[model samples]
Target chain A: MTTEIVIFAVLFLIVSGMGFVASRWRRPDDIASLNEWGLGGRNFGSWITWFLVGGDLYTAYTFVAVPALLFGAGATGFFAVPYTVIVYPLVMIVLIRLWSVSHVHGLVTPADFVRARFGSPTLALLVAITGIVATMPYIALQLVGIEAVLKTMGVTGDLPLIIAFAILAAYTYQSGLRAPALIAFVKDALIYVVILVAVIYIPTQLGGWGSIFDAAQAKFDKTPAATDGILLNANNQLQYVTLALGSALALFLYPHSVTGVLASKNRDVIKRNMSALPAYSVLLGLIALLGYMAIAAGVTPIGTDVNTVVPQLFDKMFPDWFAGVAFAAVGIGALVPAAIMSIAAANLFTRNIYREYINRDATDAQQASASKIASLVVKVGAVLFILLIDPQFSIDLQLIGGVIILQTLPSVALGLFTRWFHRAGLIAGWIAGMGAGMLMLYNVANPATHHDHFGGSAFALSKLGLDTKMTIYAGFLALAVNLIVALLGTVIAKSAKVVDGPDATRTDDYTADQGDPRVHDLEVTSST
Target chain B: MTTPRTDRSPWNWLLLLPIAIPLIPALFNAVEPRLFGIPLFYWLQLGFVLVSVAATLVVYHMTRRAR
Candidate 1:
């Protein structure tokens, strides 16, 4: 093996060791309850939540696919920056309410909140299924990040990925959420260092930032006019605004994002982290520029896999040792989110599906055990998903995931703000939103990639009989349909005096603080 | 939902500025006036992140006492 591969192996082994030893870090007497196993005992303070939620939100997809998008499509790829920028303020509005209410009832999943708020098992089930389905392909895409770095290192085939996920599954099963929470600290440290050096050092190796932007501008000047430019145009501008706003709205609705947020100990932990977590956006903005850096360095992607462009840039610019560190940063970045995602998915199953449907009498210990097993199944399923699909499809995995998850926003996010919508209305909205989203996605064809259906998130206005080639985000349109149907449905249902399900949550529950006496110790709602 | 300050705090309105600031095409659409070799398009959006942090901080500070 080359020195680069050796160094990367050593770092990977070290982080894997950290994952194994993480269960003992806090050393809970017994992690056989949902709160203890799935949420790190709900005691994480500000700094840990900052790292946890930040690490969870910004995954290997951000590292690999984002830069790749910038490298390929130019300016519109920058929607990620504004999306992340808006997400914090947007989340701070609704998520603090979620945190307060979840703590008061010891709710473990978004579905749990839905169950209590609407008193509708069916709506909760839909939200749970949506979260799981949306997150699965996203987990598979993380493997693509690791695969890109490994491919850059001249290692091919599926063995290495299988082995890496095996180790990740094992520790997550043993340690649950603590595994990812502990390793996030190390992941962020390495990512920060590598990105800091690459942004500062690599520019000097080239002419400078002046030439870098000039090179990028010059390259885009020669490309097609559709979304490819150093700046936005009228054709792509609507897409930029709608995509950023839609993604920001969808970020916290994902189960894994909620998992990270729900693990925080109190309102202040969330408050402080919401403001402080944008510190990473500074890194992400710099990281996005790595695409331009690759352009400046004349780094070409391996075999048209734009995902490999950033890793290829590292190999061509940084020394072998630092490249190994960068590779490990991305590889570990995948693992942290993957572990959390599996745990989050598993929690939804155990709490909302498995316990609710299969075994209503399951105790807290039984639920925790079920969650651990389900986490393993989730990781294995994600691994199989990557093996089966085109690894190049990582970009769309996230897009489709975003489109699917945004359907739940009307139920989960708007539900947090108001109880005006009937439960039946929320259920009908999910179906309408999901159906409309898929139909729109089914029509989005990317001729470049030769993907005929579900090819991208940007839907052409021409398809709807508009007089232009301009496009808007599919999720944005789907959300509009969802809201309209829900509004009309609520009016119809309320007027008909259709029996509304009983709401278990009190108004005060939305504002409950950490030390509130009403908050249950564990989510062992055996007979709610 | 009934909490007076949590739901109705006027300070909460400040948070909307950061979110709305970036949506305007006029704000960061130019290549002129680049910073450190970065264009206004790039640096300005990164600057919006700081804008959000500041807005969230002020809201949190102003409303924490009410909680």
Candidate 2:
């Protein structure tokens, strides 16, 4: 084996060891309980939570795909920076309320909160199913990130992926959320160091920022499309804004993002971490610039996958040893978020589907065991998604995933502020939002790729009977339809005297703090 | 559950600045006005990250103090 491959293997082995050892990092009294295993006993402080949440949100896919998108299409790819930047403030208002309410009610998933808040099991079920569906593609894309690195290293076939994931499944099954939490520290540190070095070193080598942008601009200017330049055009301007805004709305709604927040020890941990987490956004902006650097270097992407650009850039630009480190950083980055996404999806299933549908009175041990098994199933499903399906299509499906998850914003985010929207109304809103989102996704196609359905997130404004040639984000339009349907449904339900379900949560639940009477009781009981 | 602190404070209103900054595409949508060779569109959006972090920290500290 080459020295690069040997170093990559060594780093991979180190992280895998960290995953297993994480189970004992903060050994809970009842390791089999859902609270302990599913959420690291909800005892993580600000520093650990910062790394964990950062690792969870900024996945290996971001490392690979952001630059890939930028390399393929210039300014549009930078939407990710603004998306992540705005997401912090948006979630600051939304997620703290979620954390407070979830802590008071002992809710483990966003769907759990949905069930309690709306008093509608059906709505909660939709939320759970959406969470699972949206996350499946996301997990698959993480595999795509790792696959890019593996392909760069000449590691082919599904065997390596299956084995790598099997190890991830085993540790996550044994360690639960803590596995990713512990591994995130290393994954994030390596990524920060590698990216910081690459940004500084690569620019100097490429004859500084001016030449890099000049090269990028020159390349894109040669392209016939008006939207491919260094600056946004009239056509893409709306698409860019809507994509960034829709993505910000959808980010925290994902079960994994909420899982990361709920895993924190207290509300203050979340508050403090939100302030600190923007440091990663700075990293993300620099990472996105790597796409420009790839352009300046004239690195040709391997195959049709733009995702390979970053890995190929590293291999061509850096020394073999440092290239291996960068490759491992991307690979390890996949493992951290993949582990968390599976755990979050599994929690949704175990809590909402398995327990809600299969056995209402399952013991804590049974719930934890079921989640572990479901987590393994989730990993296998993600691997199969990559093996059997087109990965480029999977990337598009992630955009569709964002659209689907945004449908839940009304129920989860708005429901936090007021219970005014009727449960039936919320249910109807979800259906309308989901149906419209999926239909739009189906009709939008990329002519170049020849994909007939689910091609991309940008839909033409003219499609809605407008005369304009510009396109807006499909998610934004679908969300608008969803809100209208929900409002209309609320009026109809109210006039029809639809009986509201019994609310299990109390008023104080939304504001419950660490030492509040109700929160303290649950904490004391869970620890014992 | 009952709503938690429905009234908004002026400090809480500052959090809206970050969310609002990126939504207005016209503000930083150009390329001619570059900062240190980076386009206005890119650098301004990146600069928003610091502005956002600062805004969030202020809101956090103020809200925590109020409580």
Candidate 3:
């Protein structure tokens, strides 16, 4: 009805058409293999990988929820910058090794790497389950991004949301990872245009950067809490640091991110992308400032949804036509990652659970078919997560999702470096970390959002009997407990003469490149 | 272009610098000494992105063998 909505719908439909046709983009000889369907044939060079990975990592969540975070709570929202900036170099150090070894062993997922490196199917199962459950809320949250834009545009109801997922499901089921891979080009181009315009054009109209900061500072300073200022206070700085660090640690551990990485052509492609990926972090910084601009523009969210602040600001600040482009940037933005996530989750299920446990002798075509169906089921499940459950509760669960995924750090991240810990020790440590993380997450309450339990990630130190209001990230604390338990379990297992499990990886496998003789060939379908 | 594992350069350690730099709050948390009227807290963090991209680039090039 409105110009913005019309433009958004037109652009969205055109892109969905492109996604449908994307099955032919790189056309493998046999498109039904798990390698082709799930990973886009592992042939993306630097440029395509750049766009795909960028689109997948910086989601609709970054555009909608992040600025809303800044709109609601001031300085802590900027933690997104450090979280993304630090993640690349940290992951680059370990991820090339992951890329190399996965290629060498035909590993399709991180859990595949775990199964090979840890030699324990139980640990691998735990890692797989963690990746899947954490990603479900995340996929659902992407819809929230679209929902906010739609709600702001006067479009409401479950039908539109269901329609959006149906389109996403159709293209993804038709083309697999290639669908999102092709669609990401459009998503990133639109986002870059929208971000460049908003960051540059809007500031001049709303006085300037100084006034924006001043407004945000004034609003936060008027609040009684010490934690809401534009500058970090001592009380909440601990939360900021730990939350950022913990999030950065969890970023790549998610199955979908590894899907992006493992889909690249070779080690060099990954190496190049890591350094270049910070470009998105820089874009994220500019996007985060949109919150302050919203404050200066006097944009209030519709009712209680703080996530609508950025979209509402766009509607008010931009002409209706341009606002539509901004909305499309975010709406299309959700598709790239959500599609990839369901595909990744499906791959994990089909590879680790469905194949490893269900039918060990399942053929490649069967695995691909199963993954395609599982991807559809995952999408429907994500939609139900938003539709049946309270959407705000979905957001809270997404926060808890971060803490859930962090429990895999010891096995996924550290296991990339060493296999010294006995398999059972790693398993025990995971259980303790997961249990503690969940318990801590359950106790976190946010008076602002009015949730009594399972509210957020920041846990107060006083809860553990410390004399302070200072709180740290629950994921950070849970990870510390995990490492300690893992170390203790390792010592106990070692003294008890419990032998470490077999490691299928060789020392040289860590450094293998694309051309290395051991790197699994794309044409090889036989099991080792 | 693939360097052998035994011949890997020590320059790989430079990767840690960029990762560690952003974690230290005292380094970039200041509000004053602004850039383009933007606070140091904001612009300086964006500056760290450039710093990181540069560090990663250098390590990538230095370790990469000439074909």
Candidate 4:
């Protein structure tokens, strides 16, 4: 085996050990309860919560695909930076309310909040299903990230992925959320070191940033008009803005991101982390430049897969030992988020679906065990997603996932502040938004790839009957349709005297803190 | 049950600045005005990240004091 592969293997083994050891890191009074197993007993302070949430939001996908997008396209790929940049401020207002309400109600999932606030199990079920479905492709993308790194290291086929995911599944099944939370510290630290070194060292070695940009510009100038160029022209400008804003809105709506916030100890932790988390966006900006660096290095991607640019760049630029460390960073980055995504999805299934439907009277121990088993099943499904389908298709599904999850924003994020829309109206709006989004996604075909449907997130404004040549983000347009339908539906529902469900949450619940009377201790709840 | 906040604090309004920075695509959508050999589109966005971090920090401190 190569030195790179050997170092990568050693680092992976160490993280797997950490994942197993994490079950006892903050050992709760009872591991059999969902509160302890699913959320690290909801006792994480600022630092652990920072690493955990940071590690969760910025996945291996960010490390690989963002730069890959930049390497392939020109300026438009930088959308990841602005989207991540804006998301912190956006979530700062939104998530503190979510954290407060979830804490007061002892809620484990976003759907739980939806059910309580809207008093509609059907709406909550849709939220739950959306969370699960959105997360499945996201988890599969993590595997794809690892597969890219492994493929560059000359390890092909499914064995490496299966082995890696097997290790991840075992630890997650054994320890639940605690495993990822613990492993995140090491993962984040390694990624920071590797990225920092690459950003500083690689540019200097390649004759400075000027050459890098010059090379990138020269390469793009040769490509056809409208797609290439180092600058955003008028045609792609609207797509860039809408894509960034739509992503900012959709980021926190995902179950894993919500799960990260809900796992914190208090509102203060969430707020502090929000302020602190923008630091990653700075790192993301640097990482995106790696695409330009690849151009300067004359690093041709393996095959046509642009995701291989980063791995190939590192292999060409850095020494074998360091390349191994970089590979390990990407590989471990995949495991941390994948573990959290599966746990988040499993929590949704257990709390919102299984308990709501299958066994309403399940004990705490039963619920925890059910979540553990469900996590395994979710991981297996993600593995099959990568194995059975095209990995590129999974990436497209992730874009659609963003579009679908954004539809839930009106109900979940908006409901945290108001009950203005009737629950029925909100449900109707979700259907409208989802339908429009899917139809738009279906009609967007890339003739180059022979994908008759679901090709990408960008659609021409002309397709929507606008005369402009500019294309807009599908998610943003779908959201617009969703909101209009929801507003109209609310008017109709209110005039018709549709009976609204009872609100389970009180006014104070929206601002509840750790010491609040409504917030139950995990130990106390476990014994009940 | 405690009532929700009815009085909107001005400090909370500062948070909107960060959200507004990247929404205007025309602001930093060019390549000529490069900083340290990096494109204006790239470096300016990176600068916005720091601005956002500062805005968030200011908002967090002010709101926590209010609470």
Candidate 5:
């Protein structure tokens, strides 16, 4: 435990040192501008942006959760593998257009695009607030990942976590996007080393591949659980497929994801990233197998928490010193994504709400300062959420975030493809999607367990006399409803002679690449 | 003026080659033995690092050409 603490402490200092130095990496004379502070000067090349966004997307939760889920639920955990596989193709289709449109309109947040598209500040505010609300618990889940590692290392007390988050907030507040941008290189390097070492060395430590599988199958068969140790089953098939498709659609709609896309130098970079980023998925498949290995190794479930499985597996398999290094790897993994998510959420608040509503004529520096302060506030809020609320409950809430953010798809993702839906129709679609999504999510109960306050599933189609025995992720179903309502509303508005706003932006502008003089950075003011 | 005489082909569908390269081994592992003297799982995973680096380089070159 002391070794783990020492390694983590050293890692925290190193990460903070990187953050302080990152302010000068791009060497902007004034860090007050939103372009410099929030978006890292919008000058990231293919390699840096590739690592930054890749590191941002594939996170500690992934390192911990994918394996944990596989360990707990068997083959269903591999949903992460396929979901990631399809994400790039899905991103390739949508994000290039989003980048072009955002670049052309000087839009910093999706809500800014919504405001300009619909000429309704109210609708934009709704989108912005939805983004921030959805992003908050997601950030808290990163802390949950950190907490899982800490607990597995037998490190007690809240002081260490509080100190860790304080350091994270300080650097994030000081360095902004550049902090994550610089740290991503080191984070990816460490993760690759740890995972690689584990995949090879751990199997060798436990007998061999055949022994691991044989032991796992034997344990599952004798454990009195109905299902055996195999990957597929009649019960979980629906959940697996729907969860994957739903999560893939939800991934790029995240404000942080779009923020990453917008920071790129051109359209081709977006396309290249979309195609190339799935390289991590190949790594993800191997990571998922660690779950099965832990089961085979006679490692009893420690802490009764799924997230702690990987850390415990490490603690049992490796030396204390190496286990400390692995703990630091997972811990640092959480920080990179958590920092990016908070900044992205804060940008939505500053650009869409604080600037759009609170102070319309605010300078660029003011926007940057507001975003910085808001980011710290957001991180602190996430810390309070994880500490005060049940960590398991917060993780379940992040699944709900998956549902809520997916509701934005028709507006953000589909909007990138076409503008035929009227602003009124889009707003109506959003309200209905959100309303239906929340109601269904509220009613979802884990049938396996007895505690019934707001189970993660929205509506059990089974109760409606539907023949299907599968549970659908409520957000995916809500978006289907959103699309139908949006189309009908579009037709109604077209026939009713509603006043349409002037189309200041055209579809072709989205297809436009870099070197267009119209796309330029906006300067900002420091709020403090 | 930008040169616009010939070669208006869409920017190398082969630029998408990196995405598919990983899947090839994923397909191979579906039915094979002794990849690098380890089972399909370990070899395929360690192989991804090398594959990712190679693909990243390929992508970097392709993207650089477009610039």
Candidate 6:
């Protein structure tokens, strides 16, 4: 009925149609194959991989959450900008090795790689379950961004979300990786246009940077918090740096991030993508400035839900129709990444857990089928995460994910470079890291607001009773504990002469060309 | 993993500039002057994006040729 609604409806119809038809965009002759269906035949070129990985890594959440945090917290939120910038170099170190090893071993998930790397299926199973648990809420958070846009447009009923997700599910089921990969192209294009326009347009309307900075400074100075605006200060600087470093380490470990890596055709593609991917961080910095721009424009922070600030700013600044277009950009942005993450998580469940534990000798067809079914279930779980439970719970769960995935860095990232850590030691490290991180996170609470649910700091030196306030992410502390314990455990294991399975079949295998005859693609399916 | 270079390229050292350009303003907030009819803070930050793009393009080309 309203102009915003009309524009949104038209945009939704177009995107939904793309979602449905996306299932057929790169149809393989075989419909039942996981490699063909889940992974787009593992043959994306540089350009497609660039867009797909970019879209997956930078979500609507980044667009919304980063700016929202900047809008609310000031300079502290800028850590995201730096974390994204350094992520490329960090990824460059690990992913190339991961590509070689995974390519050589034909590993589908990081857990699979761990299984081969350590010759310990139990360790691999823990890694697999961790990936799934961490990713589920991430998928849900994507929906929250979409939900904010819909709620702003006055589309409150569950029907639209259900319908929209139904379409996403159908297309993803139909097309697998190609569905999200193709949709990512559209998603990134729209985001680029919207952000470019906002950066240029919003400033002029708000009377430029001088007024914005003054307004923000004035507001923050008067507030009880010592710092003005969202920038980090002495109180939070350690938290900022540690959180950024910890996050960069954790980013590539996510199943979806690995999914992007494994989908690349060869080592060269992986290397090229790593060097090129930092470009998104540049975009992210510009994106982060929208928070400051909003401050200058006198944009009021949206209530409770931080994701709505950008959408609200668009609605207030742009005409109703263009706002709808921007809304569609944000809405569709969530869809592309959510689809990929679900599929990646589902693949982990099928290959590592279901087949390894539930049925030892499941055929490739059965594995593929299991993943497909599991993907649907994953989507359903994500939907309930947002729709049934409090959205804040899911966001907090995402923070927990930050801690959860960091535990893998000791295993996956370190394993990429060396086997010195020992198999038993790596397993001990993972458990110790996980347990310490969770307990610290559980004990973390912000006393000021009485909001106790999501209080995990990147690190708090004060908590450990050191005189100097050395801020670090809780994950880093957990990781340190892991390393110490693992070292002790390894020395003990070595002294005892415990049996260690042979190192993954071929370390040299990773260095081989993708065209090698030994490189055979495997498909997985599950029997109902 | 690829072997670490024994001799690092000066160009790789130059890579740090693009990363630092945006932060320089914060460090020298007292003296930096405005440019292009835009405030110093705004213009410097915008320049960071341009520098990042150029640097990213360079990295992409270099990596592609490394093969």
Name the better of 1 and 5 by TM-score: 1
Best by DockQ: 4
Model 1 stretches astray by more than 4 angstroms: A380-393, A520-528, B1-6
lDDT of 1 by residue, A1-528 (tens): 277798888998998888778788777777888767887776776677777788865687788888888888888888888988899888888898898888787786899999999999999999999998888777877877887888889877766576667777777888888888888989888888988899899999998899999999888988765568879999999999998999888889989888777767667667778888776788788888889999999999888678899999999998889888888888888888888888888888887898889998888788899888887777777776565544333666777778889999987898888899998888888889999998998898866566677667888989999999798999899998888888889999999999999998988789777666776544343223
CAPRI tier of model 6: incorrect
DockQ of each: 0.67, 0.60, 0.65, 0.68, 0.12, 0.20
Model 4 per-residue lDDT tens digits across residues A1-528: 299999999999988888778888866788788878887787776677677778865676687877877787778888888898899988888888888787777676789899989899999999998888777767877877887898899877777687767777888888878888888888888998999899999999999998999999999988785665777888888888888889889889988888778767776667788888898888888888898899999999877666789999999999999999999999999888888888888888988898899999999999999989988888777777565444333344456668878999999999998988899899999999999998888778764456666667787889878888887889999999999998999999999999998899987778777776778644344333
lDDT, residue A136, candidate 4:
76
* lDDT of each residue in A1-528, candidate 2, tens digit only: 276798898999998888778878876787798778887876776677677778865676578878887887799888988888899888878888888888787776788898988889999999999898888767878878887888788876765576567666777888888888888888878888898889999999999888889999999989887767778888888998999999889889999898778767666667788888886787788888999999999998776777888889898889999999998898888888888889889888987898889988899898899888888888887776565445343355467678889999899999888888999998999999999998887778776566666667888888789988798889999999999999999999999999987788877677676766567423443332
lDDT of 5 by residue, A271-305 (tens): 66765676677677777778888897766554456
TM-score of candidate 4 against the unseen true structure: 0.95
Better of 2 and 3 by DockQ: 3
Please tell me which model should have the higher lDDT, number 3 or number 5: 3
Q: Give the total clashing residue pairs for model 6.
A: 27
**Cα RMSD (Å) per model?**
2.4, 2.6, 2.3, 2.3, 4.6, 4.2
lDDT of 1 by residue, B1-67 (tens): 3434245589989999988998987788999898988899999999998899999898878777444
Per-prediction TM-score to the true structure, in the order listed: 0.95, 0.94, 0.95, 0.95, 0.86, 0.87
**Per-residue error (Å), model 4, residue A358:** 0.5
User: What does the lDDT read for residue A80 in candidate 5?
Assistant: 67
Candidate 5 chain A least-lDDT 10 residues: A519-528
In candidate 6, which residue ranges exceed 4 Å CA deviation?
A156-170, A227-230, A380-397, A446-450, A456-459, A467-471, A505-507, A515-528, B1-67
- In the range A279-355, model 3's lDDT, one tens digit per residue, is 77888999999999999999998777787898999999999999999999999998788898899899888878988
Q: Given candidate 6, what's the lDDT at residue A140?
A: 74
In model 5, pairs of residues that clash are A364-A523, A364-A524, A364-A525, A365-A524, A365-A525, A365-A526, A366-A525, A440-A458, A441-A458, A444-A457
TM-score of chain A of each: 0.94, 0.94, 0.95, 0.94, 0.92, 0.91
